[model samples]
Structure formats: structure tokens, C-alpha cells
Target chain A: MDILLALVVAVLLVVGGLFALLAAIGIVRLPDVYTRMHAASKAGTVGSSLMLVAAGLHSGEFATFARAFAGVVFFILTAPVAAHLVAKAAHQAGYRLSRGAVCDDMRDKAKN
Target chain B: MPSAEEKRQRTGLVLPTGFAGLWLLLFCLWLIFNSSLALPILATGVVAATALAWIFTTRSTVWHYVRLTPRTLYHFLAYTGVFFVELVKANVNMLRYVYSPRIDIRPGIVKIRMRLRSPIGRLALANSIALTPGSLVMDVEDDALYVHWLDVRTTDIDEASEMIAGPFEKHLGRVFG
Candidate 1:
């Protein structure tokens, strides 16, 4: 049981770290604010949640697990809302899509 | 002077029915947070939960969304399963895009109509879309949602709605109804 628990924690931490790295690379590589927000919001939230879960599981105490669980729940609830708000604000502030962009329905609507 | 019926309608709760369930849920949350089973802690949990619930139900409009039917419970469990699977898929999709040397993405915004009538249900649907792979809801106007798609598969509104919001809507409908 001890070995199994350690293995689980190791795997979770490694996976979480990899995702966080990917998100960082994506922020630097992606073309615009909107796309970077994607990297920051989804990947970042999931990666952190995974790490928190791993920490909770590693401790093997109910209090630790409870705190970790609360963190996970809070992340899931708040991350997307924050992303939505940022996206809306950026759009309202008149940010343009990347050059490789193919379509713009909002622009078309505004024209009509 | 409003009639008793009018007052009940405004509050939107069936009273004692949902009250018990809400108390139980809040108490469980308290217990989990405290991580204690002592008699003193349990008594405090009960009191705290009850006081919180009573204050919210009486003073706020949140009572309208405090439903606790068995059907909603089942739907909630199922939604949890679906959400996790989609989250994994999203991460994998993003990983591929971030790793590839040659970036090829057809990013655009698309409008999709939602059928959910309840405020809580609509909010859930929007959040689910935002968290899922390759899609973020930029704005919501009436029944329509403006989504910033990482890859614009189609410009058609109906088709886009079916693609982006379809999976989440069914479970949310049942849960929020």
C-alpha cells in the first residue's frame, strides 16, 4: 500500500508538471491573447488541480484531503468564469484575432 | 399585503422538503472541512449549516435553485463523469497543439443558441463550454452564446450549437430541471 501510494503521487506530480510546462510554451508560442487565454485557463487549471489532488493523496490525512478537495472544487468553479470575463473584456477592448485566423462572425454581425 | 400563496410563489421553495436536504449537504460539507467526528464538532456543524441555509433562503433569491430531487442527484453524478472525460480529452488536444513545431489552427468565433431556461443551468452550460477542449464562451446574449472556437469547424449556428453545447446540455437540463 505504501509503495502504491507513492507511485500514484509521483505519476500525478509528473503529469501535472508536464501540463504546466506545455501551458507555458503555449503562452509564448500562441499568436494572440485569445489563444493564450486558452493555454492559461484550461491547461493551467487542470494542471494545478492535479497537483493539489496529488498533494492531498500523499498526505493520507482527512484534513489534508479535505483542503485539497476544496481547492479543486474552487478551481473548477472559478477558473472558467475568470476566463470568460477576460475574453469578453479583451473583445470589448477591440483586440484582433491572429493573422492566420479564418473567420469572424462577430465582425460580420457588427457590419450588418 | 401579499397573500400566503403569493409569498410562497415568490420564495419558490416547497419548504420542509428541500430544507432537510440542504441542511444535510451543508452539514456534510462542514464535517469534511473540519475532518472531525467529535460530538461538539457535529453539533456545531448542524447549527452552522442550519443558520446559513435559513439566512440564505429567507433573504436571497437563491431558494429558487435549491432543488434536491432524486432525479437531479442522478443527473448531477452523471454530469460529473462526463465532465472529467471531456477535461482529459481537452488536455490531450491542447498538448498536441502546443507541442507541434508547425502551428495550424483555424480559430474563429461562432454563435450558438441554447435551450436552457434556468439561470443556473445556462451558467453551468457556459462554464462547461469554456472549460472543454478548443472552445471558450465569449459572451451570452439572450439564448445565444458567442464562443471563441480554437478551430472553427463550421460557421452554421445550429451545427455549431450541436457540436459545442450538445453533450453538456442534456445532462444539465435534467439536473437543473
Candidate 2:
């Protein structure tokens, strides 16, 4: 049981860390604020939640699990809202899309 | 039938009907956080949970959204399953786009109409879209939501709405309705 539990924890931590690394690379490589926000929000939230779950499982205590669960819930609730607000602000502040970007329907609507 | 707005307006010292459930949930959380069942710990949990619940039930209009009927519960679970699957798919899609040497993406903003009537439901839909890969909700005007798509595949509003928001809408409608 101990060996299996440790293995699970190790796998989760490694996977979570890889996602976090990917998100970071994405932030550096993505073209614009919108795309970066996508990486940060999706990968960042999932990565952190996975890490929290790993921590909870590793601790093997109910209190730790509860706290970790609460953290996960809080992250899930807030990450998207934060991303939305940031994206809205970027758009409102008139951030330009990348050169290869195809269209801007919102800007077109605003003009009319 | 009392309108939600009217209920909000006519509130007094009387606790909201959801207070009991709220208190119980808070107490459970308290127990989990403390991981203790001693008399003092349990007593503290009850007191704290009660105080918090009293304040929450009195000041917030969120009680209406706290409905947990068995059907809604089932819908909620199903939505969660769908969300996780989409999350993984989104990440994989993004990984491919980000890692590819060509870096080809046809990003655009498209207007999609939302069918949800409840504010919470609409908010959930918007957030879900934002979280999903390849889509970010830029703004919501009236019944239409403006989403910034990483790859704009279709311009037709109906088709786009069905493609982008359709999967989550049915379950959210059931859960939030």
C-alpha cells in the first residue's frame, strides 16, 4: 500500500510539474496577451490542482486532504474569472492582436 | 410567488431557509480542516460555522443558487466529468499549437448567443469557455457572447454557438435551472 501510494504521488507531482513547465514556456512563446492568458489559465490551474492533490495524498491525513480540497475548489472558481477579467481589460485597453491574427469581430462591432 | 429581488429587499433578522444546510457544510469543512473530534474542537467548529453561516445567509442572495436536488446533483457531476475531459483535450490542443514550428493559428473573435436565463448559468458558461482551450470569452452583451477563438473555423453565429457553447449549455441549463 505504501509503495503504491508513493508511486501515485510521484507520478502526480511529475505530471503536474511538467504541465507547469509547459505553461511557462507557452507564456514566453505565445504571440499575444490573449493566447498567453489561455495557457496560464488552463495549464496553470490544472497543474496546481494536480500538485495539491498529490500533496493531499502524500500526507495521508484527512485534515490535509480537506485543506487541499478547499484549495482546489478555490482555484477552480477563481482562475477562469481572473482570466476573463484580464482578457476583458486587455481588450478594453486596446491591445492589438498578433500580425498573423485573422479577424477582430469585437472591434468591428465597436466601430459600428 | 416572491421574486428573488423582492426576497432580497424584504429580508430581516430571520435567517434564510438555506442556513441550516450552509451551517452543516461549513461545519464539515471545519472538521476536515481541523481533523479533530474533541469536544472543544467540535464546539469551536459549530460556533464558527454558525457565525459565518449567519452572516452569509443574511447578506448574500446566493442561497437561491444553492439548490441541491438529486437531479441537479447528477447534472453537476456530469458537468464536472465533461469539464475535466475538455480540460485535458484543450491542453493537448494547445500543446500542439505552441510546440509546432509553423505556429499556424487563425485567431478571431466570434459572436455566439447564449440560451441560459440565469446570471449564474451564463457566468458559468462564460467561464467554461474561457477555460477551454482555443476559446476565450472577451465580452458578453445581452444574449450574445463575444469569444476570441484561437482558431476561427466558422463565422455563422448559430453554428459557432453550437460548436463553442453547446456542449456545456445543456448540462448547465439542467443544473442551474
Candidate 3:
């Protein structure tokens, strides 16, 4: 059982690390600032949340698990708000999409 | 300096009625692990966690939105799991792309017409694309996504659009819509 637990924790950590690595790559490879921000938000929140869960498991104590889970909840709640702020700010600052792109509701909103 | 109900709410005794149960669990674990009287430690942990949750929830109207069903909850977990796997695969692919001796990066912007309506769903789609190895969500205007690819694998815009949107949009819709 202890070995099984260790294996689970290891898998979690590796997966979390992979998510973090992908987020960094996205920051570099993505086309626009807003898109990059999206990568950062989801990957950062979920990646760290996974890491925290693993830490809780490794500790094998109830308090640690509770605190870690609480932290994940906090992160999930905050990340989207931050992403919205970034996207809204970018739009307000006059970033344009590619020409072939179809449908733009924000532009319609601003037209009125 | 307050009525009973007000005081209870202020102390967070009204909601999280299972608060004490979680605290008791923590206390027992502390005693078992560290071999000590963990009442004080358990009290501290409960207070801190509750306060943190309260503070986080209070900052935005988003948190006050209606609760999610269990079906939605499972979808969310499954999506995140799939997302993690994609992230890892992307990272490995990115490394290979960056180190290739003869760089063949045909970078260009591609626009994808999207169908997701929920702000959360739209955001998830954009973020998921951005989280992939070579794609970025540069701009989103309503149902359209303007993406920047570090290396364009195809000149056909529709092909690129479908390639990027395939599983991500489907799963995000399930989770957020």
C-alpha cells in the first residue's frame, strides 16, 4: 500500500511538471499576448493544483491534504478572473485579429 | 457585540457546518503523526482554511454563481486529466522543434471560427490552444479565434483550424457549457 501510494504521488508530480513545462512553451510559441495569457492561466493553475495534491498525499496527513485541496480551490477561482481581466484589457487596447477571422461580437458592442 | 445568527455567520459557524468535522479529522491526524496534543494546531488549520476560502470567494461575483452538478464535476476532472497528457506531449514535441538542425518553422496567423458561447468555455478553448506546443491564441472576437502558430504545418487555413479545435473545443464544451 505504501509503495502504491508512492507510485501515485510520483505520477502526479511528473504530470504536474509536464503541465508546467507546456505552459512555459506556450508562453514562447503562442501567437498573441492574450493567447499566451490563456496558456499561462490554465496550465499554471491546474499544474500547481496537481502538485499540491501530490504533496498532500506524500505527507499522508489530513491537515496537509485539506490545506492543499483548499489551495487548489483558491487557485481555480482566481485564475479565470485574471484571464478575463487580461483579455478585456488587451481588447480595449486595440489588438486586432487576423483578417480572415469571422465573427466579432466585441466590435459590434463597441460600434453602438 | 452581535446577535447569535450574525455572530455565527461572522465566525463561519453557519455554513461549513462540517467545519468541525474536518477539524476533528485534522486533529486526529496530527496526534497520530506527531504524537502530540493537536487541538491548537487543528484549530489554527481550520481557521486559516476557512478564512482563505471566504476571502477568495468574496472577491468576485463569479464565485457566487450557481453550483455545478456532479456530472459537470466529473467532466471537469476528466478534461483536466486529458489536458495534462496533451501538455506533456506538447512539451516533448516543442523541444524537438526548437533543436532541429535545419529550422523549418513556417510561422503564420490562422483564424478559426468558433462555436463556444460561454465566457468560461471560450476562455478554456483559447487557453487550451495556447497551452499546446506551437499554437497561441492571439485574439478572440466573439466566435472567432485568431491564433499564432510558431510553425505552420499547413497552408490550408481550414485544415489548421480544424486541427487546433478538434478535441479541445469538444471537451471544453462538455466541461464548461
Candidate 4:
């Protein structure tokens, strides 16, 4: 049981760390702010949530696990909302998409 | 379509059910935060949850129409399963883009129709999309959501609606709408 628990913790931590790393790389590599928001919001949220869960599981106490789970829930609920507000503000501020962007329906409709 | 508050009034649960649901949720949240069964904490949890629940459910119209039931609970559990699966898929999708030798993505802001009439449902749908694979919602106008697709598969509004919002709409419809 101890070996199994340790293995699970190790895997979660490693994977979570890798996701955070990926989010960082994406922020550096992705073309524009919008695409980069994708990296920051989705991967960053999951990576942190995983670490929270791993910490919760590692504690082996129901109360500790529950607290950590609440933290994860808090992140999941708030991160997307924050990201949406930032995206909306950026779009409204006239931050344009990159050259690779295929369509801009929001802008097109506003013009029409 | 009637608003959620109107529906709640029509369904005849504007007071007791809504207040009780809010109280229960707030209390659970309180317990989770405190994470203790000690007497003082329990007493404070009860007092705080009730006070907050009353203020929100009665003193303000912001969440006066909220409803919770076993069916909603079941749907919530189901939604959690769906959410985690999509979350993993989202991570994998990012991996494909992040590690590639050449970046190949056709990002776009495409409009998708909103089927869920309730405001809470629409909010949930938008959040789900923002977190899931391939799409990030940029703005929400009446009955339509403008989403920035990391990969633009198609430009047709109906197809995009079917693809992007369809998975979440079914579950959220039952819970919020």
C-alpha cells in the first residue's frame, strides 16, 4: 500500500510539473495573446489542480484531502471566468489575432 | 422563453426550496473550508452559512431562483466526469501543438448558437468551452457565443455550434435550464 501510494504521488507530481512546463513553453512559443490565453488558462488550471489533488491524496487524511479538493474546485470554477474576462477585455481593446488566424467573426459582425 | 426566476416562480419554489438549497450548499462549503468537527467550528459554520444563504437567496435577486435536487446532484456528478475527460483531452491537444516541429493551427473567432436559455446554463457552457479542447470563448452575446477556435475546422455557424457547444449543452440544459 505504501509503495502504491508513493508511486501514485510521484506520477501525479511529475505529470503536473510537466503540464506547468508545457504551459510556460506555450506562453513563450504561441503567436498572440489569444492563443497564449489558451495555454495559460487550460493547461495552467489542470496542472495546478492535479498538484492540489496529489497533495490531498498524499496527506491520507479525509479532512486534508477535502481541503485540497476544495482548492481544486476553487481553481476550476474561477480560472475560466478570469480567462474569459481577460480575453473579452483584450478583444474589446482591439488586440488583433496573429497572421495565422483564419477568421474573425466577432469583428466581422461588429462591422456589419 | 421565460427567465429562470420566472420559471422558478412558475414552478412554485421561489422561497423554501431555493433558500434551503442555498443554505445547504453554503454550509457544505463552510464545512469544507473549516474541515473540522469541533463544536465551535460547527456552531460558527451553521451561523455563517445561514446568514450568507439568507442574504443571497432573499435579500438579493442575484441568486434567488436557484434550485437544487437529487436530479441536479446526479447531473452534477455526471458533469464532473465529463469535465475531467475533456480536461485530459485538452491537455493532449495542447501537447500536439506545443511539441510540434512546425506550428500548424488555424485559430479563429467563430460564432456558435446558444441553446441553453437560462443565464446560469449559458455561463456554465461558456466556462466548459473555455476550459475544454480546441475552443476558447471570447464573448457571449444574446443567444450566441463568439469562440476562438485553436483549430478552425469549419466556418459554418451551425456545424461549429454542433461541434463546440453540443457536448456540454445537453448536460447543462437539464441542470440549469
Best by TM-score: 4
lDDT string for model 4 (B1-177, tens) is 146568687887554336777788888988888888899999998899888887776655545434577887788779878888998999999989987988799998999998887666777888899899978888888898999999999999999999998888777887877
Query: Measured against the native two-chain assembly using Cα atoms, what DockQ does each of the candidate structures obtain, in the order listed?
Result: 0.75, 0.70, 0.12, 0.85
Ranking by lDDT: 4, 1, 2, 3
Task: Estimate every model's Cα lDDT from 0 to 1.
Answer: 0.86, 0.86, 0.64, 0.86
**Model 4 spans > 4 angstroms off:** B1-17, B59-65
The runs of at least 3 residues in candidate 2 whose Cα sits more than 4 Å from the true structure, single-residue gaps closed, are B1-14, B17-21
Residue-level lDDT of model 2, residues A1-112, one tens digit each, is 9999999999999998988887898899888998888889888988899999999999998789889989988788889889889988999999988887877889998899
In candidate 1, what are the lDDT values of residues B139-167, reduced to their tens digit?
A: 88888999999988899999999999998
Residue range with the least summed lDDT across 10 consecutive positions in model 3 chain A:
A97-106
Candidate 1 residue pairs in clash (backbone atoms < 3 Å): none
User: For model 3, what is the error of residue B93's alpha carbon versus the real structure, in angstroms, after optimal superposition?
Assistant: 1.5
How close is every model to the real structure, measured as TM-score?
A: 0.90, 0.88, 0.51, 0.92
* Model 3 residue-pair collision total: 1
Instruction: Report the C-alpha lDDT of model 3 over A5-109, residue by residue, as the tens digit.
Output: 999999999988877886687677655665456467666766798999999999998767867877776676566556656766776798764443334445554
TM-score of 4: 0.92
Residue A86 error, candidate 1, Å: 0.8
Worst 10 residues of 2 chain A by lDDT: A96-105
RMSD of 1: 3.2
